[model samples]
Target: MTTKVLLASADERTLERLSQVLAEADAIELVQVVREAANVEDALTRHPDVDVLVVDELIDSGRGLGVARTVGAANPLLGIVMLVDQAGPEQFAAAMESGARSVLSRTSSLAEVVSRLESVAHWVGAARSAVSADARSGRAGRVVAVAGAKGGVGASAVALLMAQSLVSSRTVGLVDFDLQSGDLAAYLGVHTRRSVVDLVDIAGEMTGRILRETSYDVPGGIRLLSAPNDGERGEEMTARAARSVVNALRYQYEVSIIDVGSHLTEATAAVLEEADVAVLVVTPDLPALRAARRTLAMWERLVVRQRSAVRVLLNRQHRRNEVTESLAAKIVESRVDATVPDGGSPFESAMNTASVAAASGPAHTAAAKFAAAVVGPVDDGPVDAVEEAYAEVAGRGRRRARGNDAGQSAVELPVAFAVALMVLLLAGQGLVWGTGYLLARNAAHEGARTVGLQAWGPSTPGAARADALDELSGRWRSAATVDVSPSDVTVHVVAPTVVPGVRLTSSVSAPVQREH
Candidate 1:
């Protein structure tokens, strides 16, 4: 039988090119091609028979990693292949981290693309066989997290859609732990009087009935543990409390999808530690990429120190940005596991209305495809060290930008001083002049021996005149003449002669322009 495949990408050229390549493959059928990430969920909703998903490395709006994770967590049996621009060890590693079964660079030959499709088709068949066996064996509960590398990467949106996809046949639970600004309950249009706080408050007394009672039902019987509307209560849900809630739901639900808010707070860290799998969400922007890099580094450190399973997701991918899946993976030193498309205005509308299913436009279809991949079959492999290193470097770079200051204080201080000088020259002339004079004097006094300059004024008139001229010439690197009769130098300081924080003492033989 021919394998049914879905394509999720933001670039028209890429989609057309890949579709043409796949069309030539006799073993694969291009069942659907979605332009937006949000449509993936709807596609899965409408066509439950898709065997594999070919997604771009980056989506237009949400993080591609998040989309991939959502797909993997929701479907767990679908074959996922991420399309990246450049092939590198780091890119490949990040792709795998995001839950992609395979990575294909856009530069691959059409024939190679066909060959990969055939291979993925075979893998899909094998996965289906394994899933059938697992079903018969009655062991299929999985806990997955949709977490942002930083805040606002759309992890919650991905979680909502993933839960929606699984609600059809299996018991799926959506837990929102953003606490302060969670939108899970609002997205599902469920008003829960009870929340994770309630669960935490009744930790010892928790029961299946209590959980069921607190959870609000969405379309297709998916249950949602809505976050407390009160920001203070949400804040009170500590990492320990979140762990308790997740552990409780793990026993009763077949699939538990979590929306971990941005920031590795104690609560989020706790969730990351306990989750069977984590989807690290990021965007194409530098800040998001940097955060994702840091998040990955933190996860690796935790893994080495504590052992955890973490993945990556790229969201809001567009064709215009400099940051592509390949570049992102290279920077973060990991392969992109999956990707989603830009969901467009339709997604925003759905988000506004508080309905995951209502977002059932084109983007939802793409989301469903991702969801299928999440619950589908997968092959576990060892973590890539190169990817980890890249993540470490990128994470370190971000930390430095955020004032990490790891053993480079001396270097940073000089650079910072230079920058301050430049800023003063451009924006604060009066303040800069006053501050620069005082600073320069102090620096000259401190490093006088190094620069061979005198620190104080001379006592005798003749000596003072010579000393002033010498000091001015030495410090300012400009000619200075002393008039013994005149008290001070009328010497002019030219442009480029003034060193930052350097004071010039001089007596001029002739009147001159003192360029301040």
Candidate 2:
């Protein structure tokens, strides 16, 4: 059978090179060629039977790999091969995460290119055949990774609550990928010795039975996969193992929620790359906003995910917070998709009692709505009604609070006025003192200049003193004193300020220039 191939590249030289090379191959037929990322989808639509897609890494302004990721997710059975300028571990990992079956350098020999093309074609054929035979084949589950911008941002709580919110409508699996500081199990008040680390070695061949044995059945029908108790054991779950585990989880559940904690690691990178929705949880503060930006930048640099693809969720949102949804979005350069309000005491008590399932407050309701908004289309009928009802009650409380504050303001206004008046008077008095100091310093300098001159300057010590005193004017002339000494050739000036008995003084000395 001839293997159909689609070649996509914006570079004409690359297109000519690939076309020439592919023309010599007898078994491989180039069915379609697309120059832009936007046109690749249409080309695929035209040629649905194409077995392998070979894409230039620099196509579509260097978003070719991201395009591949979108295409692979839509057509999981299709085979993809990325043509990179340089092929290394980083590029290979990025390609794999993008759903490409293989990555090859653009400079690969004709024989190597043909061989890889054939190999990917063979795998695609086998995969399609297997899916055709299996009656249980269905759409894989959606994976949502909840990552904190910094520690204490409540990523674990959000993950658990989101899972709990989703379990009512879908099968939800919650995994603690925090490694050293994972507390998903403790959050639910459950103890389990087995964790995800136990299945790392066998993740590739993970079965439903094996997963059941390793996972715990927590409240609200959430499948809980706890992290290892020992932090050192986290190293055993490598990136490869993390990817395999995610695949298995996707196959088994309708929705998998992984709390990747605040820190990024090898394993978390794999999880983040695999997640369908990567939600970054951040507080409405400057430091948390900065951390969120840094985290998104790191993901982009590593090619783990695109910055535009990340959803930023604002936690601890309050009416009085200086940072709003629009402001935060501006700061992070991403849209603020959803927000969880401050839950107050009821929310805190629920976590303390290990009864998050029973937590009922504005925050809990908002969290559920946030999960719905992030995961799938939200039904806003009931959500709007709930919000309206909360707003009305909150409105009445706000009015009462304003009334209480009015009384306090009445007492504070007089004190504020008095303080302002005192500050203005002190400022004017300081200005007068500064003028006195300047006058005294100028008189001293004038007298000193006269001592160093011979013919043109003041002739005697008394004349020098008069020159120094003349520098002062207004009230300063009578209040100020100037002294000149011919023996030491020193001059001094003193002046009184607006403040009674407080004086400003200056002194200067110059060598006497006697006739040589």
Candidate 3:
């Protein structure tokens, strides 16, 4: 019998395009085109004969993976392929961990799509044959969870960059589990109307038809299953639903990187249980360190019992008052896994301009080092004395803040200054009126005047010649002048310049103030 394939996507165009591509393959049959699973239970109930299920990375109802898991759970023998915009190694790895049979990028050529479909079909066929030959073999794939101990630890940034870094050698899928306030799509520079929430309602009946309608493909072949930007839907996910999603992704990609949000929600905990490696991200600050310590303790009490792997990463290591790696390790009661340096002014400038790829200088290098550490040896280098001193200062600062919260408030005052400046600038343009021009002109004139004065000697006839000219010009301009002696005096333009459209100008004299 010809292999029955179901295509699910958010875009009708994508569905039509993919349907057309699959139609060209003689061995595959386009069985269905669904925008989403029409209730996870029902979708599986209705499509019992679907040999292969193709889904978009983003499904409606924030439950695309739930649909995949539902299908996979109901029919373990079924083959599943996820259509992603980009297929980075980390994301592909995550997808495989989620239970996907294969993953294809939407940006890939029609030929590539066909090839991927054929490959998935072949794999499914071969796996069935292999199962008969050896029924006791373990599954191959790794799920890595990138989680922040607290908010603003840059966990998502690390996860996405790590996923992008892995694309060269591995197939990866990036799952944004933040549900609410998830910025994966924005970070990846992808805009899609449909998110995982849209898939939940129809997740039950999701065939290939439903999966094709929702996912957006990104560049470099990394598949992103983004969360709804609306924080309201965060509670929409249940632990069971989250696990379903993760399971579905496992079949399609070899590795999966889940950006677990700050809080260890039940849904996230479900994912953590399945993850092979859990990367706990934190900064060098006291609050972050405390949170990391608590989180580590909690995980040790909970998921660590299951033998789930965990690693800690320190981000923004170059801050002037940051805790030393040694102190940070001691606080967490574990050795520091890796340190990501702060990508200075240029890096932040690129991020401000919304050019993540351009801002990826230090972040890229740090990500490579981090990847190497995760995959290789844990480098335990000696702590620098300077770093220890800084850590001592940081610890004192934390203690002071804890005592009275005064230092914390004081530290936040500068941020207020920045906000106030931004508000003033935005509210009125005249706030900085002539500011740039005045600074530029003052610098230029100061340089020129210094050169001119150095060329003339004090008490010399040439100096007198210059001073007399200056006195005459000052008198002409009616500027306040004080005589040094016979010729020179310092002139001050107390009022606005008399010249048309000119501003204030002031002068200081040395020996020329009392010229002989």
Candidate 4:
């Protein structure tokens, strides 16, 4: 089919040039020619069959780029091209950000313009076809908002893994919506030249072609729309832009995973509004649980989505007795849908290699499998996906610690008993050891005084030593010794171990009494 084209240029000479180029091009027909950017949209409405829009940089009384951006956002499926002379890197970047599918130099030959138009037209057609197919099959895309119940719960990482798993059998769009500080590019090992910041200006025009230009490929067939490395740049994405971009992805891909970072914001909230499922990743700890509970309550109060739409994924779970699945669900006031084993070693390796931990190696297979199971093998389409996604783990709720006194004491009775037993054992040992030490020390002092008496000599020292041994007459008595001299006497005693393998020693000395 011949490609229908529209030309918008306030400059009469520029219009003549574009018209002449189009007339000479094969398989391209000039359908509408508007000399003003302000009149561009009306022309599109009149010529609804127009396939491509070629806008000159000088149109709209120097607001040509603004018009292009506006038009692109409203008609995302429409092909857009920016014609400029000597577009530097900055200008080219700006042009792309304004939603131009192709930016060509105004001085380019007719052949080059024809080739560019053909390429842009082809991509536009493909994008429209995909959306049409999605409509015909009643398969609106699934959107998963991976939101952290609290910071450092591995929500971003889980989001990435979910996308990776989903894309294994389907097309997935993984958007890094963590505007302030997202590292999706680093995680995917992608040195991205563009980011979501670039798409904000033309978010309304977020067609498949725009996604292709903004995203990078990662290891798991996931297309990543990286967040701005510069936090300040991230401020450019408004809530409307977020909604537009996410909505387009919802229509284009089978599944779209948005990394909403560990906390919430207007930008992230915009994405979450479209989520069929908000996988709230929380660590299995009391602090994280408390934070998650607060966050859930906030979500409910805000009425962002139904509480049922929120899926509680307790990540990095271990064998610790502190935070069980039942306990976490009770605390968070939500069902614990799934648990991901803390594959610490493999996780480190994956992050180092900038690959997905679940798909890194054999060691990470379990993590990968768990990710797949949670995200699901079933496709999310032809209906709302969250309900089905959650059905797998919803009803398996174990009874919470509920009863009089919250059943807390009953549940912890065993643990409390164990701890009490340990404390008693230690305190008992200390008492016995203290008693043994005091007795031994007293016995040694008594013996030293007895041997130091004027009438006592080396021969009589045995009697005193016996008296000292009799002071305890227990295991500690086995190693008592007394030394006598002309002027003084000394007694040494080895205190027996109160607790096994623990021994203490004591010694005492006294001046001998003499006639002088």
Best lDDT among the predictions, by candidate number: 2
Query: Stretches of candidate 3 above 4 Å error?
Result: 1-73, 76-139, 201-213, 304-308, 372-516
- Per-residue lDDT of model 3, residues 1-516, tens digit only: 477788777788788788777878777788678886754334544666666888777877555665665566445556788777788887676565455767888777767876787776665554454333321222233578888989998888888778777766666778888877778888777887777666666543332223334666678767777888787887888776666566655544556788988888888888888776789888988899889888888987875423235778898888575589889988877667888887778766755554664345877788877765564432233232223333444566556545553555666866755675554443222211222222222222222333344434465444433333332211223543333333333333333322367444444332222212
Q: Candidate 2, residues 1-516: lDDT per residue as tens digits? A: 999999999999888888899999999999988998888866876888999999888998998887886676456678899999888999987786566889988788889889999999987775554343321223457799999999998889889888988888787899999988898888898898999999876654454545777999997789999999887888888886788788778757878999999989999999999988999999999999999999999999999889999988899899999999999999888889889998878788888888876567787788889888777852222222212333444566556555554556666856755675455445434434434544454455456556655444355677667666655543557666665665333334443333578665544443333443
Off by over 4 Å in 1: 1-140, 303-308, 377-516
Tell me each candidate's TM-score.
0.45, 0.50, 0.47, 0.50
Residue pairs that clash (backbone atoms under 3 angstroms), model 2:
none
Clashing residue pairs in candidate 4 are 73-204, 73-205
Model 1: per-residue lDDT, tens digit, 1-516? 887889999988888888888877887789889888878966875778888888887775647766875676445556788888886888777766555678888878877777777777676665455334433333436788788877788888877777787776677898888878887877777777877777765653344556877888777688888888887876676665676677667656878888878856677778777777777777878888888777777767766212134556677777777788899887766667766667878788778887656547655665677777767643242222222333444566555555645556677866865674564344323222322232232222212221222223344344434433333322233433333222222333322222587543421122111222
Mind sharing the TM-score for model 1? 0.45
Worst 10 residues of 3 by lDDT: 430-439
Error of 3 at 23 (Å): 49
What lDDT does each candidate get?
0.64, 0.77, 0.63, 0.71
Tell me model 2's lDDT, rounded to 2 decimals.
Answer: 0.77
Tens-digit lDDT track of model 4 for 154-201: 877877777776666888888888888788788778887788889877
Candidate 2, position 415, lDDT: 71
Which runs in model 2 stand beyond 4 Å of their true positions? 1-138, 377-516
